[model samples]
Target: MTSTPPSPDAISYFGIEVPFMQHIGLRPLLLDSDRCHTLLAMRPDIVNSRGDIHGGTLMSAFDFTLSGAARAHDPERLGVITVDMTTHFYEPARTDLTVIGRCTRRGRSLAFCEGEIVDTAGTVVAVARAVFKLVVRQPA
Candidate 1:
C-alpha cells in the first residue's frame, strides 16, 4: 500500500493532525523552507496547578514545532525523528501561545532546530533546541 504525500496546505504536511495536537488545539499556520509557525489556544485543563501553561506542554509544543521546521527545510522530504531536546523556560505563560521554529543547520542525516514560545503580548515564555535524525525510506 502507498500513501500520498500530504498537500503543502494540509495540517498533515507538518504531521500536526495527530490526536494530541488536536486535543491541545494546536494549529499550524505556516510552514516553509525558512520557518514554521503554530498556534496553541490556551485551555484551562492544559494549565499547571499554578494556572499557567505547564512546562511539559511547552516542551511538547517546542518539539513539534522544531520538527516541523526541520522537515520543511529539507529538500529530500525525508522522515524526521527527534533525537534530543533541551528546553529553557524564561517565563510562565498565561495566555494563548504562538510557536515559531527555524532550522539552524542540516546535514546528510541530521538536522538542528530551535523554537520559541511567545504569548499574545509577544513576551518570550520558553525556548528550545533540538536535534532530529532524518531517515530515508526504501521503496518496496
Candidate 2:
C-alpha cells in the first residue's frame, strides 16, 4: 500500500517524545497502518571511530520505527516490546539517514516488522527484522 509522510500531529500521535529519540534527533516523518518512516541527522556524537553512523544508533531507530508500525495494528495503542531482532549491516552511513519500517504481520499477541535504513544518497545501509510482543500495560 502507499504511505505518505506523517503530519506533525501524526508524529506526536506515535509518541516520539522519548529521551533517546531526542538525543539522536530522530524525527518520525511518516506513520500509516502498516508503515512508518523516520529521519536522523548525521551528528558527530553518534558517529563511530571511522566517522560513520554507529550501528547501535541505527538499530535503535529500527526498533522504534518498527514498533511504531506495529502499534498502528493495535487500535488501543497497546505497548509493544521487542522480543527479538535481526539486523544486517550492508554499508556505512556517512550522511543523514532515513529508516522505513513495515509491519508484515500482526497477531493478537505478537507482530512481525521489517525495516531498512537508507543514507542521504538513497543507498540502503542496514536492514532489520524484529518480533514484538503486544501487551496492555496499566497506565502510569
Candidate 3:
C-alpha cells in the first residue's frame, strides 16, 4: 500500500540519529492538520518475549510520535519532558504496526496527547495518553 509522505516538520523534529527510533526502523508516515495528528510506523523486530511487541517499545514509539505532533504544531524554541504516561494493552502486536498520536489539548506549559497502536491487520493493540511539560529554550 502507498502511504502518505511525512511532513517536513516531522523530519525536522525526529533527527536521523535518534538511536531508539533507528534501531526499530521507525518512520513517520503522515502528518495532517485537518486531523490534528501524526502517524508513525515500526517494523516487526521491535518485539519482546512471547513474540509480542514489547509494551515499553510501543510506549516509546507513542511518546515520540506525540512529541512530533506537539512540535509540528509549535516549532519555535521549545523542548518537552514527559510528566506522566498511561497505556492500555488491548492485543498482542505480531506484525509491523502504526501509531497515530493526536494532541488533545495544549496549554502554556503542558500538552495532553493520546495515541493508538494498530497492527498490520488494523487491530487496535494499544492505547496511550501522556502529559508533557513544555519548556521554552534559551539561546546561548
Model 2, 14-61: lDDT tens digits are: 653455776777887888789989899999999999999899999999
Candidates in descending TM-score order: 2, 1, 3
- Which candidate should be chosen as best, given lDDT against the real structure? 2
Better of 2 and 3 by TM-score: 2
Cα lDDT of model 3 overall?
0.69
Sort every candidate by lDDT, greatest first.
Answer: 2, 1, 3
**How well is each residue in 77-113 modelled by candidate 1, as lDDT tens digits?**
4567899999999999999999999999988888899
Expressed as tens digits, the lDDT of each residue in 1-140 for candidate 3 is 55555544443334323456655556766655312233444445666767787888888888877766555455456667888889999998777788888878888888888888888798999998888888775543
The lDDT values for all models are: 0.82, 0.84, 0.69
Error of 2 at 49 (Å): 0.5
As a TM-score, model 3 comes out at 0.76
In angstroms, the error of model 3 at 13 is: 4.4
Among all windows of 10 consecutive residues in model 2, the one with the lowest summed lDDT is 8-17
